[model samples]
Structures are given as structure tokens and as C-alpha cells.
Target: MPLTAAVLLRSAALSDQEFLDALYLSTRDDLQALAADPALRPMIAPMIAMQQKAQGLSYQASYPGAEYLVIEHAGAPVGRAVVHADADGLRLVDLSVLPQARGQGCAGSTLVQLQQRAAEGGCELHLTVRLANTGARRLYERLGFDVVSDDGLDARMRWRP
Candidate 1:
């Protein structure tokens, strides 16, 4: 399902740190599998923080002008999306929805809109997803994105109009 007309994207603000942090944690619940190792359990928070920070820095370095947008559903924040329009066309830097928002159609609609934007620009939209995230890969595939490459950890996908 794609996003409905009720869902909107707004630029993320400095004051949204707490919201962002919670969103970040929701996506990383699998890391709890490592909690079996008492030593690693205590490091989860710091590790996730470091990982998220590194991802942020990498996105900035790669797409300095990328729009970090928060996905809002009926005026409530539901997720985050990063998109960059450059000489290479459009890059979907990141997109994540809260578990509560899953299957709500908002994300699908947002992605469809991005694909339309890429088509209007006469180029393809590119993104990479974790191989473990099959649900996301399926969504991308349903949206006409094809896997360009896959190396255990990540699979690069592209969608062209």
C-alpha cells in the first residue's frame, strides 16, 4: 500500500531528537539478540547511537543537500525519509516507519511519489537496503525497484520510470 493523501513530509528539526532516537531504536530491536552476551547487552544503547551518528555523517558527506524529512500521518510523526536529488538523479538515502505505522499505506505512497519525482527528472531512483530486511525489499520490488547488486549485508536497488 502506498501513502495516503493524509500523509505528508516535513523537514526534521533540531527539537525532534527524542523522536528520532525512539524511531532509531525501533528499527534496531533485533540487536537485542546480542543481549544473550551480558557484555554486549550493556553496549546496545551506545552502539546504536554511534551507528546512527555514523549513518548521519555518511549521509551528509554523500548528499549534503539531502532533505531529512519526517513522515507525518494526520499531523503525527510516523517515520523519517531522506532524499537527495543530484546530478545522478535521485537517491533515497533512507526511509523508516514506526512499527505502529507499518502496513498503513503511508510509506508506499511516499515511495511512489519519490519514484514519480525521479521519472519527472528523467532518471532513476537508487537506494540500498539491508538484506535482512526482506519486507522492505519486497516493498521496493512491488514499487518497481530492481536489485542492482547484493553483497550479504546490503542490496542496492534502482527504480526507473
Candidate 2:
């Protein structure tokens, strides 16, 4: 987890549109599995681009207080973490990393650090994950988060320090 020390969380900005757009694309991996045709894979990026813009606007309108952060490694943006922390706990709205950066231990290390921060404040960390994303669910479970609630499509997990 030594690499965790090198990760920087910075405030996101309008200037990061292009990088964020690309990062947003990286987060849509579930689409690949849902795609029925291999040839249609090429269309994924454009569709996601449009959806990302719409979602960005929607998120702004819905969760204005959520802290939008860009995960930077060695001065370059590599991922994004959208979080909201209050008196109750820290809620992770989203965590995404570029495909090229996967399996590098960056996201895990940073998340552990965030869990520590939440613990220091005597707050629990919470997040709702899509049920279809089993890979991410396993990761969160490994980090000590447990399922607290579930709908058919999503599960809400909580991590207490």
C-alpha cells in the first residue's frame, strides 16, 4: 500500500471535461457485458459520452454538496471518486479508474486511506453498488463493508471503523 502515499485527491473542475469524459467511459464496463454484438462495441464510447454529459448535469442538480474528486497519480489524473460526507457518514457515490490503471492497487490503497479518515472522524462509510457489478461488490467486501440493504438492482453497503 506504499503507493497510496503517492495518490492525490483533488477538487474536480470544468476544465477537466475531456479527462473526466474519458474517465467516465472507463466506468461503463458493465455495458461491455450487456452488449449483444461484438461489432456494436464501437458504438459504446459515443453513447457513453452523451450519457456522461447528461449524468454530469443531473448529478450537479441532485447532489450539489457531494465532493467530486479526481484521483491523481504522479501528477496525472487516473481516476475519479465522488463522495459525500456528513454527520452520519461518508457515502461513496462513485469510484472509477481508467482501464489502463486497473489492477495497479491504486484504488484499493486510496480507499483504505479514505476509510481511515472516516474512522478518525468516528463516521461509518457507505455506498450503494449495482448488483450486476459483482467484481466491485467483492472488492468492497474485502475492504470490510457489508450489505445493509438491497433492492433487486442495487445493494447498499456500510463500513464501520
Candidate 3:
């Protein structure tokens, strides 16, 4: 079945907590799969937990200048993307989708939404991805993000609007 065009992009509300938690939990298996490197393996769970906490806290109160968008498909929350201004451009703080929502264009659609939001704010978009996450890298590249630098395990990518 085709996903509904009714997929909506909107500011996340407090009611989305459970959906957010589900999204965080869904990434565990994927994260583990990417943790093939001995050094990276030990860091996966901690990093995922930390990111989940950070994302959850981001909904507490609106920061001075940050925009967090939640993507919903067929009335159910499926993903989230957050952008904040930085010296170089609009930094992508988070971009995550539920496991079931992967490979369904949800992440790509969220990126398009983020790019539009960034453009409206007069900024380019930037994000850091693990070098080993080729699937994510490919998605980002498809959305016009170019690799700017690699700091060990992380690659910094930028998308100029």
C-alpha cells in the first residue's frame, strides 16, 4: 500500500512523547547493526540514549532560536527533524524515523521540510553523520548534503540552499 500524502510536518507537541519514545527504541537494532567496529559498538547504546534524552528535553521549552519539526503519517507521528542556527549555517540537531517508517520516504520528506524551513530562515543546513551509516549518508547525499569534513567516526555534511 502507498503511504498517504497526508503525511504532515508540524511543530512537535507534548502529546507526542510516547511516539518519540517509540522512535528512539526503534533505532536500537539499526544502531547495533552499525556498531561493527569494536570501538563504535560500546558507544552505540549510550549515544542513542543520550540523543533520546536530548530530543525529549528539546520539547520542554522553546529555545531562543530553534525549530523542531515532527513528521506524521496517517495521523500517527513517525519521525522528527530539528534545526538550529549556527555560525556556519542551520545545524541539524536530530533527524530520526521509526524503524517501520524507514525506506518509506519519511526521512527524505522530513529533510525536504527541514530545508524549506531553513531556507525561510535564511540559512543552509548542516548535519553530522556516522561515517559507517551509508544508508543515512546516501539519503543525505540524495537530498543535496555534501561531505564537508570527517572527524574520525563522524562526517560533517552541509546542504547549501
Candidate 4:
């Protein structure tokens, strides 16, 4: 049940936009649920496209120096991660695994790799998880990340080497 597949990270390219958009859609539970209704299904594609574009622009503006990487298993991308590292610490700006790959250890392996990098750099690792995403929060906690702050909707977590 743990790390069943080996994962690798590589710099994402513009060519990966289509795959990234599909991955983004797959990771959005709310959208998927809404699309389950026949009336709403047709609207999902356009919404996903617009949202993905906005998210891309937002990330570029918010973390100008971040590394945008793709998560791959057996040579095919299954997820994506955005990380920003500086004198302060490493922040995992975003991480998302495709629905099909969710339980196949993709996310856990990726976090393990990031944790190793933080340890090697001697700086803390930081990430913010939506409070409603209890599963992901538990995963972070299991990996030694503790909540440093929490508002109503999200929790900012930190892990020290």
C-alpha cells in the first residue's frame, strides 16, 4: 500500500499543457461531482480550460522563481508539483496527482523526495493544505509535517529536517 511505484520529477515543458490540464481536472473532486449530472457535464470542459489558464497565470505571478515539475511513472506524467526554494525555506506551492494514480504511491513518493531535499538543504519544508482535504493533511502529518497555522479553510504546515 506504500510506494508501489517508482516516481520521477522533471521540469515541465509547454508541451505538457494538455496533459497538465487533464490532470488538473482529474484532481478536482468538486468539478467531477458536478459533471456527474448530464446537464452539467457539457460545461465541465470549458470551465476546466478557463480555470487551468487562470491557475497557470496565478502561479507564475505568485511564485516567479518556482520550479514547475511533472511527476512521472514509467516515462509518462501522472501529476505535477510547483516548488519554490529560497533563503527562507522550501515551499511546496502546489502538488496534484491524477485520480487514477492517487492510491499508487505517486504523491507519497514525491513528498518523500521533497523531504529529502529539504533535509539536505538544512531548511524547513512548508506547504498549505485545504482543511477539507483531510486525507492529504493526514498524509503530511504522517510524514512529520505539523500544522503551524490554520484559518477556516486551509492549514499551513511545516516540517523540519
**Top TM-score: which candidate number?**
4
| Structural similarity to truth (TM-score) of each candidate | 0.83, 0.81, 0.74, 0.90
Q: How would you encode candidate 3's per-residue C-alpha lDDT over 44-104 as one tens digit per residue?
A: 7677878878755764453446766788887878888776776777787778888878888
Return the TM-score for candidate 2, rounded to 2 decimals.
0.81
The digit string of per-residue lDDT tens for model 2 on 1-161 reads: 34644878899998988999878766666765555578887887778877887887887776679899999887888999988877678988889988877777768866887899899989999888999989789889999999999999999999999
List the pairs of residues colliding in candidate 4: none
lDDT of 3 at 146: 95
Per-residue C-alpha lDDT of model 4 across residues 75-149, encoded as one tens digit per residue? 789999999997769999999988778878888889999999999999999999999999999999999999999
Candidates sorted on lDDT, descending: 4, 1, 2, 3
1 or 2, greater by TM-score: 1
Task: Give the number of the best model, judged by lDDT.
Answer: 4
Lowest lDDT block of 10, candidate 2: 27-36
Query: What are the lDDT scores of the predictions, listed in order?
Result: 0.88, 0.83, 0.79, 0.91
Please state the error at residue 71 of candidate 3 in Å: 0.9
Worst 10 residues of 4 by lDDT: 1-10
